[model samples]
Target chain A: MKTLALFVVVITGAMLIYAGHDLPAFGDINSPSYQAPMTQYFINNSLEESGVTNIVTALLASYRGYDTLGETAVIFTAGMAVMLLLRRRER
Target chain B: MSRIQESVIIRTIVRIMVPFIELFALYVIMHGASGPGGGFQGGVIFGAAIILYTMIYGIAEGKKKMSDSLDRILASTGLTIYAATGLICIVCGGMFLQYRAVPLLPDPAEVSKYLIDLVEIGIGITVLAVMISLFFDVSPPESEPEEAEE
Candidate 1:
């Protein structure tokens, strides 16, 4: 198990290093992370349409909420599993 | 907890500061749509409120206010609100949570924008509740109210 873990970590580190080369130039202001496409769309349309001040908030709450919902479900399942494990059994 | 209770000065200061911290959390939750803050950030703040309750008063007192049953229900309810909202979008004859198909208002494009924010609120609540449950599950047995504080 320890060897397997070490192998997994090494492969993950290698993949990250490879991917890092193609990454968007370490945070350029005009890069996709900065002034990219989707943020602009949310900024242009959702602000006045939704009457929300923060464009990022509007995007997260509205556009990507489905993904967020799935995340919540995942957490709920984990909590339930833990409860089953730890809660004392009835005599 | 024992340390905090032992220090009179820390106790007085935290007691005074907790309300203000909680107020900031509420502000984060409410004003999430306008700025960098939103449901997720605000929800974490809400969890922090409970953490404060646990720290100062002890886990038993905290657990009195929030039991295992409460955490389970909250965790489930949060997910239900989120999933149900998505199912509503599907029932309205759209793809899974595809807001354009939901017929929210006369101006289809307009509602699409607003629907996103509402969905985000549901997401925030669910995620926060679940995270709190997870936090407690991994908490040391020393902190388990049934074992110690109770």
Candidate 2:
């Protein structure tokens, strides 16, 4: 079982390393991500639209606020689950 | 674990550092609008402070600081704040979570920024409370259940 797990890890690591070659270089301006229309729109107007200097914060808290709300719910649920499962009956 | 816990240096350092850790966490949450932090990161950091305190001081002491009831209240309050903000937007004639339409501020962009900060705060509060609660629940006093059963 340990050998099989090791084999799986080695295969997956090799695949990931091979895939890395196709990725854009760090901070490459001409990268496909940088050229996306949405990326350009965010860069151009996030400050004006959201009044936030940080683009990531603007996107998370305003443009994608609903998604953040859902994520908060997920965290809350997980906490509740842990509390319920592990709580001892206080006498 | 008991030997380390009893070490005066370890206890003294943790006692001194916990307040600073908490302060930094608050800074991260507040400065997240203009910097490299947000609700999740800040919340986790804040939670870590309490967890560290619990580890050093024992669960009973930790519980004294943040009771189970308080933990539950704080967790719900964070979610409530987020949901209430969305509801306010809806009441103000906008879709849910539409910060610009809330009409609290004249400038739409300013409104968005303000709401974003508020939402981040709510996330921070919930995440911090939940993390503390999870730690306490998962690592209860080993003799607690046996004592109760007896």
Candidate 3:
């Protein structure tokens, strides 16, 4: 059974690596995402729109602020859950 | 943990290093707009400094610095800051989190820059609080509370 499982894992890993060959090269302008107008628009306008030099920050904190808000809530929830589970009761 | 606590050299190094680590975290959060780091990364770093201190000093001393109530309060407060920033945009007659809609400054771009900073700060606070609390919660209580009866 263990040998069969290892065989399955090895085959899957090999297949994944083989499939990864079709992926676009680093920073290829012809990549599907780079070809998209939305990506170009963000690149062109993010600095002007958000006055943030860092594109990632503009994307996270301004363009997609709602998503970040949810992410923050998720972290808070995780902390609360851990506290409830692991914290000792006061004597 | 006890072995480290007993080392004067280790204790002194950690005590000296924590403040600098915290300061660097603040720098990362503030410069998120222009640099590689953002709230999450900075918060994790900040929490790590505390965790390092806790690992050496023990959980009891760690709790004294960041009590359970304080942790809860800070975690909620960070989330509140994020939500409030969005709500304020709505109050300013813009959609939620519409930074340009805020009338804080003459230039909408300028307003966005500042609001983004505010949002980043909110995120940092929440992430920092949560990371510390999670560490405290997950780690075993190696030292018993002083008040515990024998």
- Listed per candidate, the RMSD to the true structure in angstroms reads 4.9, 4.2, 4.2
Predicted candidate 3 versus true structure: per-residue lDDT over B1-150, tens digit per residue: 456578999989999999999999999999999989899999888888887887787788888888878888888888898899899999999999998999989999999998888888888988888888878766656652122110
For model 3, the docking class works out as high
Q: For residues A1-91, what per-residue lDDT tens digits would candidate 2 score against the true structure?
A: 9999999999999999999999999999999999999999998999998899999999998888899899999999999987777664653
What docking tier does model 2 reach? medium
Which residue pairs come into collision in candidate 1? A54-B34, A61-B116, A61-B120, A62-B116, A62-B117, B32-B38
Residue runs of model 3 more than 4 Å from their true location after superposition: A88-91, B142-150
Pick the winner on TM-score between candidates 2 and 3: 3
| Best-fitting candidate, scored by DockQ | 3
lDDT of 2 by residue, B100-126 (tens): 888877899888888888888999999
Cα deviation in Å at residue B17, candidate 2? 2.0
Off by over 4 Å in 2: A88-91, B142-150
TM-score of chain B of 1: 0.76
Alpha-carbon local distance difference test for all models: 0.66, 0.87, 0.86
> What TM-score does each model's chain B reach against the true chain B?
0.76, 0.92, 0.92
Q: How close is chain A of candidate 2 to the true chain A, as a TM-score?
A: 0.88
Runs of candidate 1 exceeding 4 Å displacement = A1-24, A29-43, A48-53, A88-91, B100-117, B140-150
* TM-score, A chain, model 3: 0.83
> What TM-score goes with each of the models?
0.72, 0.89, 0.92
